[model samples]
Target: MEKNEKYLRAERKVRALKGFYIHLIVFILVNIGLFFIDLIFSHDGMWFYYPLFGWGIGLIAHGISVLGFGRLFDEDWEKKKIEEFMNKD
Candidate 1:
């Protein structure tokens, strides 16, 4: 039982770490893309700034998806698991 619990915890931690790294990579890529788009297009006044604004919006959406939605689901799952473990003990 203890070994199984340890294994489950390890697996969850590994998955969370993998997701964190993936999000980091995606965030970096989006920012880089925004920079290039701004550099190439915004030749006039602040037209390119539009894309930056869009990027900001995208970041907020991503944050809600990742931190809010993801964490909410994870917390529910963790809570259920904890309840089950406690019941078993």
Candidate 2:
């Protein structure tokens, strides 16, 4: 029973880590796409600055969603960490 629980916990951790990586990749892709779009539309220079500014804002929002917020709770990764620590004794 204990071994099965441990395996399940590890599986959950892997899934959560995978989710984090996916979000990171999405963030990078969105930024890159926006940069290219800005480069193309900014032929007039300052006009494209707004999009770049918006991109910065979007980045911040994404960071908050992925890192600052309680996304860790959704993954239950911290709970597993605590359990492992408690079992160390």
Candidate 3:
């Protein structure tokens, strides 16, 4: 049972990491296309930065969640919080 749980957790982490990678790939490809489109059609103004920066923020957040920042809120933290609240009651 314990080993199975560990496997499940590891699988979930891998899945999250894979999702982040896919998101990154799409962001890069789409932005590259968008940049060229803007350059060809809208030469008078540079507007690619808008979607680039906006989607960039989301991509950053996703990367952080799958990479390191998410560790701060894992099962241990949840259990500790639950224990703390239980003790209060």
Please give each candidate's TM-score. Answer: 0.51, 0.50, 0.93
RMSD of each: 5.9, 7.2, 1.2
lDDT of each: 0.70, 0.68, 0.95
Give the clashing pairs for model 1: none
Residue-by-residue lDDT tens digits, candidate 3, 1-89: 49999999999999999999999999999999999999999958999999999999999999988897889998879999999999999
Better candidate by TM-score, 1 or 3: 3
Model 2, residue pairs in steric clash: none
Worst 10 residues of 2 by lDDT: 44-53
**Which residue pairs collide, candidate 3?**
none
Model 3 has an lDDT value of 0.95
lDDT of 1 by residue, 1-89 (tens): 49998899678867766776676687668777876776787776545456556766866666665556756666558889899999999
| Residue 47 miss distance in model 3 (angstroms) | 0.5
How much is 47 displaced in model 1, in angstroms? Answer: 7.5
lDDT (C-alpha) at residue 46 in model 2: 44
Residue 71 alpha-carbon offset, candidate 2, angstroms? 12
> Model 1, which residues run further than 4 Å from truth?
45-89
Q: Best to worst by TM-score, what's the order?
A: 3, 1, 2
Give candidate 2's root-mean-square deviation (CA, Å). 7.2
